[model samples]
Target: MAEEKESAEAMISEIHKQITDAFDVFDHEFNKTVDVREVGTIIRSLSCCPSEGELHDLLAEIEEEEPTGYIRFEKFLPTMTKVLMERRYRPIPEDVLLQAFEVLDQEKKGHLEPEELTKYMSEEGEPFTQEEMEEMLSAAVDPDKNVILYKDYVGMMTVEDN
Candidate 1:
C-alpha cells in the first residue's frame, strides 16, 4: 500500500509538471496578442499578488472571464487566497503603510470596503470585526486609507517613498 501511494504521488507530480509547462507556453503566446493596456493591468495585478491565483481571479473578474475552467495558478494566489491556501499567518508590509493601502485599492477608488480591506488578513480564516475594518479604512488612524488620486496610482508602490 505504501508503494502504491508513493507511485500515485509521483504520477500526480509528473502530471502537474506537464500541465505547468503547457500553461507557460500558452500564457506566453496569448500575451503577445493582448492589447497593451490589458497587458499592463494584468502585470499590475501580478505585482500586488503573492501568487498567480489571485492575479488570475482578479484579472478574470476584471475582464469578465469565466474562472471555472483552467485556473493555471491554482496554488499561486493573492494575499487573501494565500492565507487560506497555506493555513498560516504571515506578516504583511508593515512600515509601508501608505503603499499597502494604495495597492489594496485595486479599483483606485477613494477608499476600500471593509471586506476588501480585511480580505488579506481574513483569507487565512481570520475574520475581521467592523471596528478593525474601520480602523484600517480611516485615514486619520492610518494614513494608508487616504483616497489615492488617479495620478498617484502609478507610483504608489515604490520603495523611494520609504
Candidate 2:
C-alpha cells in the first residue's frame, strides 16, 4: 500500500515538474505570465491538443483575458488543474456548453435557432468568423428541428478532430 502511494506521488510530482518547466519556458519575461500566443503555442504542443476554436473556448473558460491578452500563472491555473485531473481528456464540459448556448438562446428555448446562433457567434466576445460559425452549425445542428440541442452541442465541442 505504501509503495502504491509512493508511485502515485511520484507520478504527480513528475507531472508538476513538466508543467513548471513549460510555465518557465513560456514566461518569457520571467514575470509568471504569458501572452495569448504563448498560451496557444503551449496548448498546441501539449498531449491532448485542442483545435484553434477550442483553444478560444478554453481561453474564455479560463477568463484570463486582459486588455493585452496577457494571462498570469494564477489566472491560468484552473484550466491546467482540470486538464491534469482528468484521467482521459474529454472536450468541453456539458455545463460549459450549456452556458455558452444560453448566451445565444435569447428565447430561453434551451436550444439555438440557426440565425440566433449565427448572430451570437458573430457578435459575442472573441467572435467567430462566418466560415467558422457555418462549419460548426453544419456539423452540429439538427436539420429536422433547425436547432442545436445541448447534447449535440456538447458532443461537437468534445469531439477531438484528428
Candidate 3:
C-alpha cells in the first residue's frame, strides 16, 4: 500500500515539473505568473486535451479566483495537477482513432485528402474550429502526398501501452 502511494506521489511530482516548465515558458515577466489569456496555449502545450467548453469553464473558474487577470504558479499547480491525475486529458485510444479515420476513409483508400479532412472536421458534429483543424493537420498530414495516412495519424494521437 505504501509503495503504491509512493509511486503515485512520484508520478504527480513528474507531472508537476512538466506543468511548471510549460507554464514558465509563458511567464516571461519572471513574476511566476501568466496572463489569463495565455492559459489555453499553456494548457495545450502541456498536452492536456480539454474540450473547448471544458477549457472555457476552467478559465471562468480561474477568472473568479484571480480577478487580476494573471495566474500565479501556486494557484495554477494544484488545479492542473488534479486535472492531470484524474486523467481528464487522457489521449484517445488507438482503435477508436483508427475507427474514426476509417469512417472518414469512405472510399477505403486508407488515406484522406487535406480538403476532405478540412470539410469534415469543420462541418461535422462537434466541429473543430479553424485553429484546431490547422493544428491537427500540421501534425497528421503528409505534405508530399497532400493526405493524411490515417494509421500514422492514429499512432500520433495515441500513446503506446507499456
Candidate 4:
C-alpha cells in the first residue's frame, strides 16, 4: 500500500514539474506575450509527489503576471509530519522530518513556503515535462501536509515509511 501510494505521488510530482516548466517557457523567459497554446499544453502535469509548496508555487506563478517562482504554505507541512509518523506504514524517529520542517518553516510557524519546499524536490531538470513533473510529486508532496512534526533531528527514516 505504501509503495503504491509513493509511486502515485511521485507520478503526480513529475507531471506538476512539467506544467511548471511549460509555464516558465513563456512566463519566466519569453519574448512574446502569453498565448493559449502554451497554456493548453500544460494541463497534463500530474501531482505524484507530496510537495504542496511546489503545486502552490506553480499555481501562483500561473495566476500572476510577474514571475514569483514560489508559493507560500499554510498549515499543511507540519500536518504531513504527523501522518508520516504514523506507525502503520513504518514508524521512524519523526525528528528528522520535524527538524527539516523547522528549518524550512524558518519563522517556526509550522508552515513552509514554496521556496522552502524546493529542497525536497529533485535538482536535476532533465527529462522535463508537465506530465513528468506531476508524476514525481504525487508521492513526494503530501497535500494534507501531515508527515513530520514535534521532534528533534533524526538520522534517517525507512524508505518504506517515506
Q: How high is each candidate's TM-score?
A: 0.22, 0.47, 0.81, 0.24
Which 10-residue span in candidate 1 carries the lowest summed lDDT?
A: 153-162
Most accurate candidate by lDDT: 3
Q: What TM-score number comes out for model 3?
A: 0.81
Among all candidates shown, the one with the greatest TM-score = 3
Return whichever of 3 and 4 wins on TM-score.
3
lDDT of 1 by residue, 1-162 (tens): 999999977865654554344334446545323332343243333233234355445445434244433333443223324333343322233345556666777776655554554566556445556675565445322246544342243334333311
What C-alpha lDDT values do all the predictions have? Answer: 0.44, 0.71, 0.85, 0.41
Q: Which is superior by TM-score, 1 or 2?
A: 2
Candidate 4: lDDT of 78?
27
Q: How large is the C-alpha RMSD of every model relative to the true structure?
A: 16.2, 8.6, 2.6, 17.4
Weakest ten-residue segment in model 3 by summed lDDT: 57-66
Give the winner by TM-score: 2 or 4: 2
lDDT of 3 by residue, 26-130 (tens): 999999999988998898777776777898888776564538888888878888888887877666678988998899889999999989999998898779988
Per-residue lDDT of model 2, residues 10-96, tens digit only: 977776676667777889899978887778666644455566677777777765434467777776665775676573344465677
lDDT of 1 at 58: 47
Superior by TM-score: candidate 1 or candidate 3 = 3
How far out, in Å, is residue 3 in model 1? 0.3
